[model samples]
Target: MASRAAAVALCCLLVLAGCADSPVPTDGADSPSATATPGSSTAIDAPPAATPKPDAVEVEVIDIVDGDTIDVRFPNGSKDTVRLLGVDTPEVHAENDPTEFPGVPDTDAGRNCLREWGERASQYAEDELAGETVTLSFDENEPRRGYYGRLLAYVHVDGDSFNYGLITKGLARRYDSSNFQYRERYGTAEGIARGTGTGLWGACATESPRTATETPIPAADGGPPLWVSEIHADAAGDDRENLNGEYVTFANAGEETLDLSGWTVSDEADHTYTFPEGTEIPPNGTLTLHTGSGEDGDGHLYWGEGSPVWNNGGDTVIVRNGSGETVIEREYGG
Candidate 1:
């Protein structure tokens, strides 16, 4: 009886061991911490890094001149006029010069249409950038200022290029894009703008670009056939020390020789230089007038001023015939 009872007890122990829960899975999902709560997590993923903005000089816009121009005030109490680089809007001011508009018809109606589009461009800029803080960037290959004495720079607002925005919106055409750093990017945007008929290209009645058939004759009425071709406003060093480095270049686009005798070249400050009686520019030739005193020859004239004549900041070049009629107007720098 005692042996049988012991045997039963041993069997009972074996059965009890077999019925116990398999060893708790401590290494996996069955572990007490994992199974107890799926609601909590302590790990956190980090955020991505932010991109850096390029360097630029911050300035406040004082006024909007037009679609492509604006007046800005620097941190110093000084001010300047800035011409939007790499883009040329339709001319609200250059109404009489129909030829300036490449595809616009050479008619009163065409010029009117062009000016209307210019107004729209101006309004757009006013609405967006008027009196706002905008940054400016210069092109290393181009002049810091134009012949007109306006600051030549790319305007940036809210980290985007306003100059490029104008092109993509069709408000302006690529002005002097060959030397521009973003020429290819601008060209691509221009193609898309043209295809979509964005702004001026869509609003104005534009014709296909016409090929030049013949040389355009000068105006029969003695209108000045001269235009400001180039201006070296800033010198390598100090402008006052290096006067010859700063100069304005005038070119004759007419077929006939131009007699600049008695014509006065003046700046916005009214610092005037009257060409000597025999100053004649041959057709398709250029006459560069330097700021420093030098014997005038070799397609060069001298302004004969000790101090700088053109302002490196901003100014306009006005050329008028003896009769005081404004003939040539070229503005740059700011």
Candidate 2:
């Protein structure tokens, strides 16, 4: 009896030991506490990473010149006129240059519309940016001077690009130069504004582009012997740096050979080049007047100006015959 009782006790002890070696099953979903690897997570509803802001310098905006230009004072107490990079705004007539807004039609209705939009754009710039402390970032590819010697920069207020904001509101268009930074972004913003018919895109009907042939040229008093054919304002390479590469071409449209001697090609700034004696243009032939220094060559005349005379933004080219009467008045750029 004792042996049989001992055997039963041994069997009970072995069964208890077997149970202790086995792992307990768990209802992982329902359980408040479950064994898991330390610091491991399921990552339910995690937030996305934040975008990095641009590297920039803090500057005080002294004046908002236009939608794309501002007078800014840097931290070092230096002030400069900074032209906003990657954007172009509608022209607002300055107090000094009342005719600065080029190509506005002579009609009262057209003039009124141009004035209204110009005011809106100017007001928006003043309201949002003038006298504000903002950040300025320059393009890595293009820094310092832009066209016309203005400091090129990207202005940011409260971490958002002010240049891009103008495009979003349709007050500006994407003007991509050779070293175009943020081209895709500015283009996308412009597309969105245009698609939604916002601001100028909706309000102005005359800003539509015209083909070269569609533009009309005024007839000269001598029955229009020649017409201004083409202009290369922004020349390619370091050649543009040299004043001579930029030129305006004139074509003799009449059948007769015309004497260009004593004729003048002048810009609004009064930079004029007088044709030398014995200079002539043959029928259906072209003559190029260069802005830089060069010896007089066939179909070419030099302006001999030390600095650029033509405004890259906008300018009027006035051509006159020997009598000093306006023969051809051509306007380009805005």
Candidate 3:
């Protein structure tokens, strides 16, 4: 009897061990902490949604002036007289304007030729600008809206620029200001146009002398002559490395030479650089002032024997002629 009881006890222990080894199911639910479900598809967290970018303003061209200036009709129904930021076109007199072609002959033939060239440039500009949309950017020096309340903008048409196009076609020359950001590209385009003898080159050829009597003249006392119209910072060559050593330039607007000996350059820092006794700028010329030592170029002025005015950061520059007259002033923020 004892042997039979012992055998039954061993059999019960074996059954209990088998039940413990088997996995038991709870109420029809999965484990709370489990990442994957048995026989179910693998789950993945959705990636965070990307942020959207802001929309850009749209611009359209309505009319063209030579290859540079344009009439752009803004979304607000106002007409904008848009000057191509980096280009200067040959002078074209308005209809019946007595003083239109200064320094150029007013003969019927010369006038007709000038008109034809202007028209041709305008035609080319129209072809490029018509029905085209562009992105417009502005320089800090330019008013958001011009004095006339017209929208002022530097246009980027297609991937290339219409401003550069003018220079490439010789319809325009580079017109840089201290605030212009696209200096290098404009300079290159102007150089190319000069070499090619395109629109303005052929139109204003020395062979055909045009009269200057009809050329427009600014008010005599008008704040500083137009020759000192635009100022620029020389950012080329080694000057690019030193910010403070940057130089400021003056451009002559008229077709004659300008004397700048009595001119003075100053900044907010109270630093003043007076022109040496023999400074002169030719027609449509450029005068540069650098920090370091160097001979003044044919159309440039070097300041500070060998050091630049501003170092490697940023500053403001003001140019004035004798008599405490202001020629040009610009606050640079590089």
Candidate 4:
């Protein structure tokens, strides 16, 4: 009887085991697929892939010079100036011409209005490119460097061409020259921007009431005894060929004749021109210095450089005393 009872118990246990739930179905995806391996975790989560960048050369921005110029450092640890390809901004310096910027009237107020627009464009570029890492694309046909030894390139910020953006916004024109590859596309974008009256196009539509004479150039304080009244950096022709065309005008505002013995005038590039021992300017008199070889006169002097001295782009005119003390420092834009 006990053996029969044990057999019955075993049969009941088998029946209960057979009645258990079947294995849940999973189409492989929902299943725990990790197979524990030696020296590896059973559950491994793969990291996400990183964002991809363009195949172009990358550069770190050192400075945003203006609307269309930049200073950059390459991966090889070299620094260079990059002039944005296929674009031209308004002149921020003293020189302004209505013919350069279309639709602006050829008047003092109109030029001043354009200058204001130029300042706005510069500010906008600063906002866009300040400390931004960018990529560079070259025009295969044109030379790598421009006349000023600045690299000619299309700056890519986040893969979009910043040069094109400038044209689309009317911050710049489609560059005066036709050397670049994207001239057609850039021209089209510029037309659209011009039609829509964007940026400079719309901002300078009307002439400002304030004339150029109304806004006299402010005197630069802390300069040498002589006051720098004017600077003509961009000459009429090729600056290298016409060195004497680029000159600086200084005035003696005092009542007595001033002696400038041992004073030196230097540019940002350290091209210095020293005043002669007997250099003197009479009361209420003026003097002009040219950047080429010439015979010195009562109020005229020369620097006698083989090439150009003052930077047409922009520069700081520094005047030092005989003892090498900085008596004058003046900075200006091109």
Worst 10 residues of 2 by lDDT: 42-51
> Per-prediction RMSD in angstroms?
27.4, 25.8, 27.4, 27.9
User: For every model in order, what is the number of clashing pairs?
Assistant: 13, 1, 27, 0
Give the per-residue lDDT of model 1 (tens digit) for 111-172: 78778888988999999999898877665435544545455677877767788778867787
Q: In what order do the candidates fall by lDDT, top score first? A: 1, 4, 2, 3
State the lDDT at 33 in candidate 2. Answer: 32
What digit string (tens of lDDT, one per residue) describes model 2 on residues 1-334? Answer: 9999888866654443332223323222112232332211211110011112322456788998877788887655667777887777766764222122223344555556655676787789899998899866555445345435566667777766777777767777676543444664455455434434567655654443222332323335554366665667776666558688788877655546778778888899887888889988765456788888888887788878776777777678888888898777777887
Instruction: List, residue by residue over 72-139, the lDDT tens digit for candidate 3.
Output: 65454444566655455554556422123322355665666666666777777788787687655544
Q: CA lDDT of 88 in candidate 1?
A: 82
lDDT of 4 by residue, 72-158 (tens): 876545677778877888778666777766677888877887788778778877898878887665554355455565666677776
Cα deviation at 220, candidate 4, in Å, is 59
In model 4, the Cα lDDT at residue 328 comes to: 55
Q: How does each model score on TM-score?
A: 0.45, 0.42, 0.40, 0.45
TM-score comparison, 2 vs 3, better candidate: 2
Worst lDDT window (10 residues) for model 3? 41-50
Better structure of 1 and 3 per TM-score: 1
